[model samples]
Target: MKTSTRLEQAIKKLYVAFHNNTLHPECCKQCAVGNILNNTDSWKHLSDYHGALELNYIGKVNESFGRKFNGYSPSELLKIEATFLKACGYQLPLHYKNSKPKHPTNKDVLFNGLTKVVTFLCELDGVSNVMDYTKLFEFINEKPRFQLDDVITF
Candidate 1:
């Protein structure tokens, strides 16, 4: 299968998990993605950009929760990150010196991509509209407002 196909399928799986309220790793006793999301401390790290989804962040989460590290590889982490962020129509948080992506990133493109994901999520959650769902997530709290014509380099 193509990479895009695989990603789409993964996102669908994620949607199901969310819909079922089984997104927690402990809920199903499953993999790293659920583990990370279910742990509030870990999720905060990702949300706050305290660390990337790398070894250090995992270690910190593990320490915070008193859970032993489960020895997931870097590629595994990247795969998980890609799937989760893509499901939210987001890329990995950029933490480099310039805080820019290697590829061009525009607000319209991101907004559109996010709209697709958010719309699907809304439908799954039985939310009838886009604005309603965004309000629930409070997603724009710290981000720049995305206008239809706004262009961002990252």
Candidate 2:
């Protein structure tokens, strides 16, 4: 599937961050947006609060100036962060004591966050969700590869 060059780059970065255990929802420099921006915390200035979708004064100025970090506008970046936080079970506007996963580096948790971020990015770019595998389930010869309830004998 064809994807924008920038989105492709962003996905690669996020994938690496997830596998390298560098992705963290709490840290601005290691969060989804940060990873997409080359692990820079500067994207935090785009919003007054972490996980917020509203752009602050600085963010508005940057948006007005048509500035993009790794090809994402200020608003897009904010949305991406918000999506990641939500997927990771974070309360909006992240707090030190807020309810979070017991192990942030847990692969399952990170994968959930990555899936959400990738979905949002795909939507933003008007492309199909890269993480979606539903198409792979489409029937061939009017039969699925396997039944959902099928038991495996190993």
Candidate 3:
């Protein structure tokens, strides 16, 4: 399937990070968005607090000017990080007081975070989520129940 250049690049980076054991939920420089941005922690400046869904003043100004970091706007970056963190069992605005998984670096935990981030990225790109497997089961009797194009809407 055709995908935007930026989307493809982001997915590639995530793919490498997931397999290379570089994805760490608590580290801004090693999380999903961080890996997408080439393992940089700069994206954290987009939000006042880590794991926050809202952007800070600087992030708002950048979004106003259509500024994008690695093909993702400041707001989009914030959302991506929040989604990853939440899926990895981290409480919002992550901190010592927030609830988190007993094993943040566990492969299963990281995989869950990666799945959600990829889904969110696909949503932003207006494409089918690459990780979605339900479509494989959405057929019957050696025939398709729906057209492939219909799946893209999801």
Predictions: Cα RMSD each: 16.4, 6.0, 3.1
> Model 2 off-target regions past 4 Å?
140-154
Give the CA lDDT, 0 to 100, for residue 37 in model 3: 91
- Weakest 10 consecutive residues of candidate 1 by summed lDDT: 23-32
Q: List the global CA lDDT of all models.
A: 0.39, 0.86, 0.88
Candidate 2, after superposition: displacement of residue 64 in Å?
1.0
Off by over 4 Å in 3: 138-140, 143-154
Give the runs in model 1 whose Cα sits over 4 Å from its true position: 1-16, 21-40, 43-54, 57-75, 94-154
TM-score, candidate 3, is 0.88
lDDT of model 1 at position 117: 46
Residues 1-154, candidate 1: write the lDDT tens digits.
Answer: 1223323443455455555544432121222244433323333333334224454565555556655323333334334544434533334543445232232233343334334544443444453533342333333778645543232111
Q: Could you tell me which 10 consecutive residues in candidate 2 have the lowest summed lDDT? A: 145-154
Residue 134 of model 1 has an lDDT of: 36
User: Whole-model lDDT, candidate 1?
Assistant: 0.39
- Clash counts per candidate, in order, are 0, 0, 0
* Clashing residue pairs found in predicted model 2: none
